[model samples]
Target: MTILLVEDDEVDVMNVKRAFKKNNISNPLVVASNGIEALEVLRSVSPDRPRPKIVLLDLNMPRMGGIEFLKEIRQDPELSSLSVFVMTTSNEDSDKIEAFNLNVAGYILKPLSMDRFISAVSTLNSYWTLCEFPG
Candidate 1:
């Protein structure tokens, strides 16, 4: 299954790509710079390009943020069931609480170190491999 990564920072996007490569994650990784673009991509799913099995989202962005994206999706019946994991720099309790309230699958804090970041991605890779997702 494909994985969607919604992040505005180019550096963070590169980091995720690097981590996926290091972890030997073969899933096709699609990217969107912001929540608005992400929703556009998700809604444009076709037989050739299926919807992402999960979304790895960043909280802060220019046009639309992760929290807003979560709220929007949760309110739409067609998108509400999409599995989303918050992978962001925000470590505040409020952010975590709000994310959980919106029914996010998991909330992950971005690691400062490259090694730790790769380790976290490796763990996520393993988790997705073990879990069965709906089509």
Candidate 2:
């Protein structure tokens, strides 16, 4: 499964990568620094490669933000059904509600500990790996 990680912070990105590595998730991972970059990656198509199966999004970003990004994706006919999960540091209830309203698959609080981070990644990987998809 291809995964797109949309985060602006370098440290957060590195931590996520470490978690994925610890969990042994071998899917080709893609990085997007912000909402605009994420949109470009999501809409891009390849003749021989499948689109990203999941998007791990961060709420705070420059140029564009996560809620706005979600709105854009929801408005697009082609990308409306794509799975997006919020993996952000923000614990705002308003943000969570808005994300759910916009059809986010899940909202995860960023874990502070390395072990918990790995566990979260493993759980996410397992959930997506077992989910049914169009053939």
Best by TM-score: 1
- Candidate 2 regions exceeding 4 Å error are none
Off by over 4 Å in 1: none
Return model 1's CA RMSD, one decimal.
0.9
Q: lDDT per residue, candidate 1, 84-118, as tens digits?
A: 99999899999999999999989988866999989
Q: What is the C-alpha lDDT of each candidate?
A: 0.92, 0.90
- Per-candidate clashes, comma-separated: 0, 0
Best by lDDT: 1
lDDT of 1: 0.92
Candidate 2's displacement at residue 119, Å, is 0.4
**Tens-digit lDDT track of model 2 for 1-135:** 788999999999999899888888898889999999989988886866667878999999999899999999999998888889999988999999999999999999975688888888898899999998664
Give the TM-scores of the predictions, in the order they appear. 0.96, 0.95
